[model samples]
Target: MSTGTERSPAVVGKLSTLDRFLPVWIGVAMVVGLLLGRTIPGVNDALSAVSVDGISLPIAIGLLVMMYPVLAKVRYDRLDSVTGDKRLLAASLALNWVLGPALMFTLAWLLLPDLPEYRTGLIIVGLARCIAMVVIWNDLACGDREAAAVLVAVNSVFQVVMFSVLGWFYLSVLPGWLGLEQTTIEASPWLIAKSVVIFLGVPLVAGFASRYFGERAKGRQWYEEKFVPGISPWALYGLLFTIVVLFALQGDRITSQPLDVVRIALPLLVYFAVMWGGGYALGAAIGLGYERTTTLAFTAAGNNFELAIAVSIATYGATSGQALAGVVGPLIEVPVLVGLVYVSLALRSRFAATPPKSIVHHD
Candidate 1:
């Protein structure tokens, strides 16, 4: 791994307390959410009372707060150079859109054949490519920040067009061809559009607008150094709040069905390993080098769970097995990917890294 300043010693010491202890906080949030859900008689009912298209309104607001800063942190100005590398672009797209979905389909079926709802939920997870947390993972692994930003922007755009189409192909058509039981759920174009528009699109535009105007008003240095840190803490706060609310609503069901959570978790664990490993191997095989390779692997491994959960709950119900499966995704992904960050660090020495000309990073 590159050292601290040079990407070497790319270890836990480099992370802030929030990022370093993320898994613990997430676990605590889950426990607290469960307690609130079970202890309070009408907590779930009250939380679910104010609904934004089936999801609790509090969760929706928390999501917006959680995402805005993350999106704002991305260096949108770097898109031009990243997109110039057609090889990296093509590899990322194939891994994310084509191979990623196919692999998840195989795993979900082979692993959870008897559970159609969970299988369908997993399939939706695969379809909703990463737009949010992958950047956090890439950063942790000392990956190329600009490349991740561009790739995430690409995935966000692709979701509008491809999520529904792929959802149909994988969940409905492919199953029919193979003579497996098909899921009754139909992926809605509008659902993806609205989620992307609100969750992804709204923050995206706000982030970009803030970057443009902030820099224009006070210069990049002031904005990056002064302004960014002030707002950074809210990201974790929003994430924790959202997690607490989600689990609070579904806590009873999740606590009750331990076996089902394990089953859903197994396929997701396998999916992350295969995707991350496969992505790194491909990047290294194709000579993308360390930084871009790390970015590629993370972008490939991560999925848009927010979109997946929103789609599941809106299409099914708040308490459906599909929604439950959707909730389990990040629960499994957070820690697994954190471990993978160290794996990427250890593996970095194996690759010969050639630094690009004049790459700018502010973190």
Candidate 2:
């Protein structure tokens, strides 16, 4: 029997409301971004600042603030219970690194060949997975929060290594069967490393350190009650705003090429459906519980656009189709994942009826 404390009504209610309304809020923000982008042509560049340290300080700040609360909830020790669950980890890795990319590549080839601009966009978007938003979605789905946290940490580490190598190889080395030109794709190892450090690594360290010291100085209960909940929604809102500003910056380009939205949306929709279904099946085959299965499914299906966007800009310039495709990813992903969270909750009853598996521990 589980001894974990049930969530408080207030926390549950707030989460529920956020889950219900977040999509609408994001939609509104996206529209607002388009309008703002149209009205303020130079606003995106204006909001962006370059530092002597060779970084975009404003974007980095937005990413840090957006990522902090999500990472703060992660507890790395939770992976011990299933250290030997190589099947689960293997499934996730294959889906994220291998199958996901293949699907994206296939979809881009099939659906976006005539649209070379959108083709590159789809490639960049599909190559990434959600690092921050998945945490919020997992929590809302009543997932094993600890497990979700561990996966976030794992994915973060893996992306720093894989994104540069794979992105370069994908753009430069892959055969022209997919229409990807070497000149169109550019990868900068240094810039990608900087973006990961600024956007993910720094925030993770800061969030963890803050949580650790706060728990010690106050107490675990106080930290969870007073801090976590307070910060969670705000972090989400921050992310939404940052995305809005990004879209606003691209508003004129998007407005000019309206069909690009449909082109970007189609592959993303296909990617989400295929990955979500595959993730759920793999998790079930591994006998993970409902919460774990749902967590893995959504995490697998979602794309980490923050890193994708950063990489796209660094590699292909801010105005490149690849960068635009990265931006379009969240527009589709956020709403779709929110809907899937509810779907997972509805399926919880079916999963709960199965016999429980032994809780295996690993270090």
Candidate 3:
């Protein structure tokens, strides 16, 4: 008989109430936003009245608030153990950086050929791999927790470097190379770089500084156990506010063209399934066993929807289709990924009955 630890998590018990019903919250936010925008005249215009760097100031503030808490929760000091395992690290890097982005690019273009704004938004989504929530998914699925931590930390750093670069390349150069008439990306590389710096850079530095000082002052235990829980809810509050404002600004278009929301959702659904399945199959083929394989799959599949929304709004304006596409990301992702947690558990039997490789020991 398997030990209790060996058994898959009863997914319901593992997740917090907030995380378990995230889709419901997101749905309510959408409805509330739509109602606010539709029922209240001038709601959209008033929100848009204040602009910072050509984007609505509330959105910029919301993005920073949403991202900083999540980033602060990362254990940046623990990257050393994960680095020793070259095979795991290499596979994660390739799947996250290479396959993940490329697949999303292909899916976005193929599925969204006519809608250039949404297509570019999806590409931005692709470039942003590995979300903070993957930890919850991976843990519920019995994945290697340490590996997931390291990968999240790495991707956090990786995105700061590559988001703008990939945005420029995929939006401009790749389309040129493919001989396809790309949509006019009003934001140049310089503009994208500026957005990335303000949106990602500002929060990143703040997160790092807070953790560094917080831990030093009160020890890692208190910082994580006490300080983190205190601030974690702000991420959700920020996300809700950002969504409310975004949907409010674009609610008229979204309500009129409901088909556009459906279109944006289709590619995201495909991207999540393909990335998760591919990662699992590759993991089994390479003998990472169950835990590491599960970790690989969740990390590979999850996208930084918060960052995607931030960059999209900052670059394309809150009312643009690109922003709408980014808004639709977590809408589709939450329920789909929650379902995948069960799928991962059910399929855990397929891996060989073996203890996962003891590369990095996780608590």
Which residue pairs does candidate 3 place in steric collision?
A: none
Compose the digit string of candidate 3's lDDT tens values, residues 30-119: 788888888899988888888765556887787778777756765567545557868777888899999988898899989989988899
Which of candidates 1 and 3 reaches a greater lDDT? 1
Pairs of colliding residues, candidate 1: 2-7, 2-8, 3-7, 3-8
Question: Which of candidates 1 and 2 is the stronger one according to lDDT?
Answer: 1
Q: What's the lDDT of the predicted structure labeled candidate 2?
A: 0.69
- Candidate 3: what lDDT? 0.74
The prediction achieving the highest lDDT against the true structure is 1
TM-score of each: 0.89, 0.83, 0.71
Q: Candidate 1: what lDDT?
A: 0.81
Flag regions of model 2 displaced more than 4 Å.
Answer: 1-20, 49-58, 82-84, 176-184, 353-363
**Span of ten consecutive residues with least summed lDDT in model 1:** 1-10
Candidate 1 stretches with Cα past 4 Å from truth are 1-16, 349-351, 357-362
Clashing residue pairs, candidate 2?
A: 80-362, 129-303, 129-304, 130-303, 130-304
Question: Residue-pair clashes per candidate, as listed?
Answer: 4, 5, 0
